[model samples]
Target: MERAEEGFGGGGILRQPPAVWATAGASVVAFMGIGLVDPILPSIARGLDATPSQVSLLFTSYFLITAVAMLVTGFVSSRIGGRRTLLAGLALVVVFAALAGTSDSVGQLVGFRAGWGLGNALFVSTSLAVIVGAAAGGSAAAILLYESALGLGMACGPLVGAVLGDASWRYPFFGTAALMAVGFLCIAVFLKDQPKPARKTSLLDPIRALSHGGLASAAAAAFFYNYAFFTVLAFTPFVLDMSPYRSGAVFFAWGVLLAVSSVLVAPRLQRRFGSLTVLGGSLVLLAADVVVLGYGSHTTAVVCTVLSGVFIGVNNTVFTELALGVSDAPRPVASAGYNFVRWFAAAAAPFFAPKIEEWSNVHMPFVVAGVAAALGALVVRVRRGSLVPAAVEPAPERVAPEGAEVLAG
Candidate 1:
């Protein structure tokens, strides 16, 4: 089997076709919705006269629906095709995000967020498959491109949120709606309809895909890792106790580190040490960072929180590569399966973190998150054999097409 090189020295990353760039542009806006609310969480609570825990349900509703909706994304995309799926997802996001801005109560906002999540599930899952199919270089290059969009969007989400949200919390939602509308238009204008897969995916296909040991192991590890990831994302705003602009600045810096490491640094580390080693070590460091963030002084916590982004960036790239390559199931089915398992943690972390703080103390949630990060590393170690050897090995000088390489195995 031809292995994918971990390096991007050939300018492959930048030499994408116009369709790829257009899709990537839309992807950036879609991912921005993930962190767009971080800078405004406190403001939302105050504006709506809700508590931290109540406000945290924004993540809960969004990710819970997202997790469930993952089961149906493959089914939808396979039938309607990628372009329509992408367009449908974008339209829903545009509508629901606008509605969320108009929400009068926390409950109303949560419901709108759930609608947004459903849309996100359709777009995000399909976007990966679309990029992999249409991208010029190979699956590795496509995955890196996707991560770039994720990192950039995550980095910018807070800055935009802070600026707009400082005026009113609702402004960020409206801003997201507007941005997504632009993305919708771009995709509508620029993207051609993708050819449907030979086999249409069923709702149960993703569940069945998890029966594969490698895909299952990857998903399990990602589930635990996501707990730690979302803790920083959803919980730290309250802990930092900074003004919206300051918190936005902090997370913006964090997102820059995340983007840099993901696009530029992770491949180098993977090339040197291999993907599994890089991932496991990064998780360990992330666990330590979480511990410090939980117990250290405020200034230390702030620094560690930003530093956690480096580890997160590396893990995101490696895990995504693994998820796409590990299973015999089609990319869409495997991705759906992987996302279905992992996003539950994304939903649970934000909901439970604040409540955990309220019940015990502010520090306990981070302690739990740290433990979860450690367990993620453990899962990777324990299941290393089941994962594809190619993922951990350096690429050969001559690489085959992604489809040919997978078939050769």
Candidate 2:
């Protein structure tokens, strides 16, 4: 599957090495656990005799920490190196997953989940740096690999959880832990550190990146985008509950389509239309999908669910890429900046969703998402932003694709 595609070897557009792709594979395996819980929340609640609220926090706490840590992980990865940081994060996943899955009490599960939060925080924060850092010289193939892993993780999460949950709710957690372990092993075997950059000794860096309008814009867009995503995700079920509509088949279709489109569908589209067009169109489609999903019932919901896969597939790669591409600050620092903004916004969103829902109804969250998405697109156009690859001019083709956009260069 190696592209063996040529790209810049120096000049900041150098090719990514094989080890980097292997590491992304490991990350995909480890990270896929994030979505597994969605399919079996009730199982967990019943198994533990916990309230629905407690079961719900499983998703909330993990994402809250993941988003918050994105800011710091970037900074930390640059200082420490991506491989080391990623390895440390993966190890923590194993420890925390075991603890949470095996816990005899609901409190123990919640506490261990918080521990999982720590590990995931490190993983989510560092992985992007590692991917972008791996692309230091620019291999678009590297970009594809990293994106594929993320997509793969997200796409398979629910289905994997569903399959494993059949055995037991705890079974899926154990399964994910085991997958993470294998990923750790692959990373151990394949990755090696490249020549290091001299660490900077300046306090002015922070003020510089945040001050960069591109960085701020990317972070803000990411925040609004995720806020909408999580808000809809957390509340969609409640909305479906309000109607006579059944959610199971719709969710399964959506989840399966999401997995398929990411792994099998988007690559061809990305190769053809290029990342920017795909990303821009995807964001537009996502908003449209949310609207249809919000207003419709049963069959329309299913159609919206399937189409939403395309939207997510296009974007799953792009936004994260933007977080890395928008700045030339020490990578970790830039990543930290983006993640801090993203997660902080995301963490606060759920707390505020009730107000949004109370102020309106289940439909309100989707309306908020649609507005954020539409406005974000407009902002990009006004600024002539380079956040998405299609929005910019061609760089050296080898580092990217033919007509692929250069980030800072």
Candidate 3:
């Protein structure tokens, strides 16, 4: 049998079935929703006459619902199957994105974004498993493909938002809706139903999966890491005080670096060192970078912001590998549980970063984010014993047929 790292049937990462490509394609559109509103944040604040904290609720609401909804993804997917679950998620995104475009107030927009988050939760949690199952290569290659889509979508989201949001804050929402509609059609046509688990998952299955010490450690560390990650994504646009086009350009660069490092750099680092070592070091570097971002001038801040993407990309791939491989649970269950813990940080950072600024100076938020990243590193250090090495495979053991087998023969 082929080694897991060598990939399935000796196929390369790029070679995959149509189902994998379709799932990955939709995943790109799904991830685009993450950064799609970034360039439009200031526009939304001004256009709706809202405070920065209120405007930041766009991220808060979306991720808050996503975090909570993760619990149900396995339950839903196991029963209805992957293809239907993906379609349901796409349908929700289409409806909510269009509704978000039509919102008259920050309140309405936040609510619509919350609805969008529910769809995002279902789609993202299921898409990873689908890609892994259908891809020609093994799990590592599938994850790289997913991360590449994340990078591309994140990169494109800002550019799209800048072009459309410059005219009006609402146009990006409508654009996302239309694009997801196309993604919906693609998945419908090209993706077949994924194989379901033998046992239907309960709503609490994800929660139970966290009982494994390694899974719990990975989730806890990722929770703090995501806090730092979203601080860059959801809060920095306001700190820069740039127009839609300029902000979009900067984040686009950041996203490009993120994509490249995730695909090209992370795997090499993993091979050279180990996943835990690489993750810990990357977290420390990210912490240092975020602190400098807090204290730096505009030029320094922009540079640090862009450079931080490299560390972020590495951390993302490593954490994902740990989450999926460290535990014995089903992939979907493990992913759901991992995301359920980490996405709360995605929600909390956006809401609290602006609030922190309101209560203190602007720099305090990044200071807090740096501390959070450091804590993530600390978690890795403390939990080192609990985490299983992701590359190690179990030894194969065979047993003879129970009833019909003869003695010694």
Model 1: per-residue Cα lDDT over 163-197, one tens digit each: 99999999999999998898888788878889998
Q: Where does candidate 1 stray beyond 4 Å?
A: 1-18, 131-145, 388-390, 393-409
- Deviation of model 2 at 61, angstroms: 1.9
State the displacement of the C-alpha of residue 346, model 3, in Å, after optimal TM-score superposition.
0.8
Whichever of 1 and 3 has more lDDT, that candidate is 1
CA shift at 220, candidate 2, in angstroms? 1.6
What TM-score quantifies how close candidate 2 is to the native fold? Answer: 0.74
Top lDDT: which candidate number? 1
TM-score: which is higher, 2 or 3?
3
List the candidate 3 regions with Cα displacement exceeding 4 Å.
Answer: 1-20, 132-145, 388-409
Per-residue lDDT for 340 in model 2?
63
- Worst lDDT 10-window in candidate 3: 400-409
Q: Candidate 1: lDDT of 33?
A: 87
For candidate 1, give the lDDT of residue 298.
Answer: 91
RMSD of each: 4.4, 6.1, 7.6
Candidate 3 lDDT, 1-409, residue by residue in tens: 1232444345556788777888878777787788889888999999999998999999999998998998888789889998889999999999999999999999999999999999987887777667777777566566556656766887787888999998999999999999889889988988888888899988898999999999899899999999999999999999988999998898888888887676567767877897788999999999999999989999999999999889888888778777777788876677778888998999999999999999999999999999999999999999988875543432211100000000000
TM, every model: 0.90, 0.74, 0.89
